[model samples]
Target: MTTYNPNQDAHYQILREMLIEARQARGMFQKDVAERIEKKQSHISKYEGGERKLDWIEVLQLIEIFELSEVDFLMEFQRRVFEFNESTQTKVLQNVAKNAAKKARVRAEIVRLMRENSLSFSDLAEPPIRTRRHKSNR
Candidate 1:
């Protein structure tokens, strides 16, 4: 199984984007949100950059400051996450498939080389290392 970092994951990425979008929708700048929430502008910037994660307290404060409906926020967030997830997943899989095809072509070339040179599959392997053994004490 593959584990992606939070930055690479659609959920966190979408959350960060949605946060910035909500703030922008309200015509609020980082300075405004910072002042209203009693935080530094860097705090707003950091959280939106995914440098800092927003806890429930900050979340509620932003929700209030943005005047976003709870139901609307949650629904829109879910929809965006789903759409981002699907599209990004498809892009990643397509790249993987292209890489697989390229590798297959390379392997075919290697096989052709082996046939021309009359070499076995073992010819592709590296030589084994030779280990020296010290004489055993009687």
Candidate 2:
């Protein structure tokens, strides 16, 4: 029995492994992928050699071209895809939270201005600033 060991090179090693395995399983030559994808056979060769990276769109095309239909097959491909999406979403959420803090500061400034002007809520069509006022005696 042999344990499976994938390449450790970070440059599309997984992509290359899956690409070649799927292609061979489908009886596809490198030329077939090139013809279907409108790319050169050398490009496909480089991609399968773990020397090239494919974008998401290109990966999808390759998936469809290879006719991958099994759950295990899909999971292998989608694992990296999900990680990519998750990291992208984290960045977007961080930016949104930063922008919201800035907006809150600006809103506080606006409310301070309304209080300095003694403006009512109706006068500005905005809520009046809440404050704890003290009573004075003569």
Top candidate (TM-score) = 1
Query: Model 2, poorest ten-residue lDDT window?
Result: 4-13
For every model shown, the clashing-pair count is 0, 0
lDDT of 2 by residue, 19-109 (tens): 7888999999999999998989999988787667778778778888988755666687568656755776798899999999999999999
Best by lDDT: 1
lDDT (Cα, tens digit) per residue for candidate 1, span 65-101: 8998877877988898778778878989999999999
RMSD of each: 6.3, 15.5
- Deviation (Å) of 89 in candidate 2: 26
Identify the runs in model 2 with alpha carbons over 4 angstroms from their true place: 1-11, 70-74, 77-138
